[model samples]
Structure formats: structure tokens, C-alpha cells
Target: MNKLLIFDLDDTIFETKSIKKESVKPIFDQLEPLLINKFGTALTAQIIPELWKYPFDFVAEKYKFDKHQNTEFARFINEHEYKLNIRTFDDFSVVENLKQEKILVTTGFSKLQHAKIHYLGIKQKFSEVYIDNILSSERVFKKGIFQSILLERKIEPQLVYIIGDNPNSELKAGFELGLHTVQVAKFGQEKSDYANYCISNFNELIPILK
Candidate 1:
């Protein structure tokens, strides 16, 4: 039996679908000044998501903003509004009821991710949480974070399962460690490499975990 079940935070465990959109609108106003002042005008908020995928300094260079401005921007974004959407997809409850020790292994700033977990009401469900801070400054994430978890807990790779949306990083890293990998694909997602199984809802994992 799998002793540990690892999960990705965004788009996997907690999604924005069930949240009230109106509650999150003020977040745009909160960060608009940083964007406007550094870049001379606010780019569409849509770019914020893409901006996070790369280092702020590199993004600043790409946009012709002063190099240090990106650090300020990243700091502001990292600190604000993570509590806006405290809702999760319906199937997330399946994870809560599981017998195995559930661990969150996501890549991002811990402050923001932790706030999301707290507000989303799943923080208590996880026995452990590991955030890959390397993602904040790098795009290609290959660092073996699970190496520490395995050694510390003495959990064998074959007895663990990693579930996430990203095929390249999350699934690939777990697969390389010889752990079972599951890609929690979004609707219309293409095939995910390195996944032992791919499913759209956490409900599907109920039987798999059994």
C-alpha cells in the first residue's frame, strides 16, 4: 500500500472554480501600482500568471524595466491576496479522507502557497508540506526535493505517489525517483509524460488509493 500521497497545490487540490470571483477583484487594484510605476503602465493582469513562470529579474529585462524593479514586484506579489479564493474543487475532499499520510509537494513561494492552503481549508489535511522555492528564480525545475523527504522519513520510493497537473516538472521528478506518478490533468489536457495514471478528478484517485 502507498504510505504517502503527494499533491500539487494549484489546479490540482485547490482550484478557483468554486470561489466567488467578486471577492478576488480587489487583488488587481492592490498590485496595479507596482506594475504601473515600474513599467510606466500596467500590463494586462493576465500576464501575471506567465510572469510567475520566470524569474522577476529576467521578466524585468524582457520588459525593459529596471532589473531591481522586478524584485520589488515579486515581493509585492508574493505577499498579497493569497487568501482571496479559499475554495477547492469538489473532489478535493477525497484527499482529506484518505488513510495515507498526504504530503503537499508544490513549487512556488511558501508564504503565498501556505496562505492559500490555510484559506482553502486543506492545510490541516496534509501531514507534511514541501514547497520548491527554486521555482521562484528558475524555469526548469529538476532539483530532487523528494530526496530529502525519502531519507528523512525512510519511505521507499515505490511506496509513494505524486499527483499533479504539470507533466514536465512535477510528474517527471517523481517518476525519476521511482515513485508512482499521477497527472491530475485539467479538462482538455493532452497526455502527460511520466505519469503512471492520469485522471481529471480526485475522486478517481479514491479507487487507485484503495
Candidate 2:
């Protein structure tokens, strides 16, 4: 059977912490003063973390920010402010080599994720892009999103392979779907059960994929 490879966007493909520390972090820094000015310093600190957890729309709703402000903030973080520090590992090329059959699966804001993909110039590498809808956050859980992908793509379970860093959700999704699972922990993060195979970096993936 022909193989299908699926990948997670953040951390799995590109390093997200670098972007968070560089681009998004500054927005939070800028917001701190504004938040403190309006909501008081203590309240600002208390709410900031929670705001980070919520999606921009949810944050906007909970905080009652105007649509213009929300749009502006999103534009600032996604378009102008954020920087893509994407480093394609040896394994990345291995996967990209399979572009004819691979798909990029990401769960998050469509605009933001697409912006990053465009910024990195990796849009051509993916046969299909699966993004989470703003209405439902089911994509955050790998199993739910993977099932949707399987249904939409009409892929057989045995022909699919999911490669990612944190194996928790991805592995679970793959296991449930009976797809092969490959865990790449190049960043050294600890992973849970469900990883059929574990490799430390992308270099290792080349051989495995072969």
C-alpha cells in the first residue's frame, strides 16, 4: 500500500518556543503595560496566563475587547510581529521527500498557522493542510483531528503514519486508527506510551522512512 505521512506543526516541524520567545512574547510584554493600566497590575498578571491558554476569539469574548482591537492584536502577533525561526532538520527533508504522500496536520488558528507556514515557505511541501476551525477546538486533541483527517482524505488506517514530538495525543490517534507512529524527540522532551518507534532527531527518520 502507498504510505501517507502526517505531521504536527508546532515543535514537531518547527520550534515554536523560539517564535514564542521572540515574537509572541513581546506582544505579551506590550500588553502587560496596557493591561496594568486598565485592569491593575495584580489583575493583569492573574489574567495574562489564562489569556494565553484561551484562543484569541475566546480571549476577546471573555475580555470584551472590540473586534477592531482583536483584529489588530491578531495582525500584530501573526503578520508584523512574529518571526519564524524554522530549522528544517535532516528528518524534515526525509519527510519532505515524501511530499507526494505527506500531509501537514496542525490544530490552531488558521490564519496564524498559515502565516507561519507561508513564512517558512513550506506550504508547497504538504499535500494537504488540516487546520482547526475556530468554532470547534477538537483539533487540539490529536485523535479527534486525526479521525477527521482520515474521513476527509479517505485514507486507510494501515497506510498512514503520524510523526511528531510529543507522542501523547499523536500516538493515541495513530493507535486508535491503527496507523504506524513515529516519535521524534530531538528536543529531548519525555513522551508517553503509544510511540511505536522513538528516534531522537530528524536524521534518524531518513533511514526509518526508507
Candidate 3:
């Protein structure tokens, strides 16, 4: 069987969880004053943590903030993170050595995600990359992407594996599509209910995916 492996970009291939934490200060410095003015200091502190984890679209929806108004803030975050070079956690030699085919599916705007991929020098790592601007919902977007890829490539659902950190978005979609689902987790964390397999780091994928 021709194997087709799908990986998520953010926390899966790149160290998005740690990068998000490291980015908080620089991101805060750029956006906090505006937040203070609009939301007051108390509420600003309360919301920043949640906002830090996910995309700005979620932030826009939750706070009723205009998505257009957040362009500058989002740019600052992307640019700032670019400089960090928060590359793949594992050396990526494992991926390079892998025999199975692979692709990237992630939910985020194209510009920033592409920038990160370019700077990280991993553009060649995947056969295809999908950085979708999610409509309807993130989960729906992922499932649709998975289905489309399956149809477009004429791939068998059972021969596919979707790997990601976000259980709800990537892993769940893969499992629902009858593909193998792997959840990459932070060290010592519990595996998600949606995952058939889990690993504490990206390196662990080599053996299983091999």
C-alpha cells in the first residue's frame, strides 16, 4: 500500500506550544497597551492567556473585536516569531529518512505559516502543505481538507495517518475519516481521546511511521 502521512504544522512539526509561551512577552508589548485602552488592564490580563493559545479569529469571536483591526497585532506576532526560528523539535532527520509520503495540513493564514515554513527550511519536507483560512469551523475545515485530499489523490483512508497536536482539529478529523490518528503531546501529558497513538515528542514518530 502507498502510505500517505499527514502532519499538522503548528505544534506538530514546529514547536508551537513553547513558541507561543516565548512569544507572549513580545506579543504583549506590542498589543497590550491597545488592549488596556479598550478592555482595561484587568480584563486584558484575563484574556491574553486564552488569546495566546489559538488564532486571532478565535480572539475576534470571543471578544467581539474586529478581525481587520488585528492585522498589525497579528503581523507583529508572525514577524517576531519568525526571528525566533522555533524550528522542528526533533532534528527532522527522522522525517527526511522516512520512506512514507507526507503532507502538512494546518489551520492558519497562509502568509505567517508560509513564512515560518520558509525560514525553518522545511518547505521540502512535505509533498503538499495546506494552510487554510478556516470557514465554518476549524474542525470542519480540517475534515474537509482531509476528505478532499483523499479524493484528489485517490488515497485509501486506512493507509493514511494524520498527525497533530490539536486533537479536536487534526486528530479527530483523521479518525472520523477512518485514517490512523497520532497525537503529539508535550512531555508527560495524557494522550487525547481522539488519538489512536500518542507521543511526547516528534522524534517518537519515526519508529511508528517507519
Best by lDDT: 3
lDDT of 3 by residue, 97-197 (tens): 77888898878755667777887788797899887764323434888889999999898898898988887688888888899998888556578888989
**Which consecutive 10 residues in model 3 have the weakest lDDT in total?**
131-140
Worst 10 residues of 2 by lDDT: 132-141
Per-model tally of clashing residue pairs: 0, 1, 0
Model 2: residues with Cα > 4 Å off, grouped in runs = 20-22, 29-85, 133-141
Give the TM-score of each candidate.
0.75, 0.70, 0.79
Q: Which residue pairs in model 1 clash with each other?
A: none
Residue 132 lDDT, candidate 2, scale 0-100? 57
- Among residues 3 or more apart in sequence or in different chains, the pairs in candidate 3 whose N, CA or C atoms overlap within 3 Å are none
lDDT pick, better of 1 and 3:
3
Question: In model 2, what is the error at residue 61, expressed in angstroms?
Answer: 15
Each model's lDDT: 0.70, 0.69, 0.76
Q: What is the alpha-carbon lDDT of model 2 when measured against the actual structure? A: 0.69
For residues 1-210, what per-residue lDDT tens digits would candidate 1 score against the true structure? 447888888788766344554544455465567676654553645455545455333455566755355455556556566546567877877778888888887765556666777788776788877777633554444336677778888888888888888776778898888988988886658767788998987788878776
CA shift at 81, candidate 2, in angstroms?
6.1
How good is model 2 by TM-score?
0.70
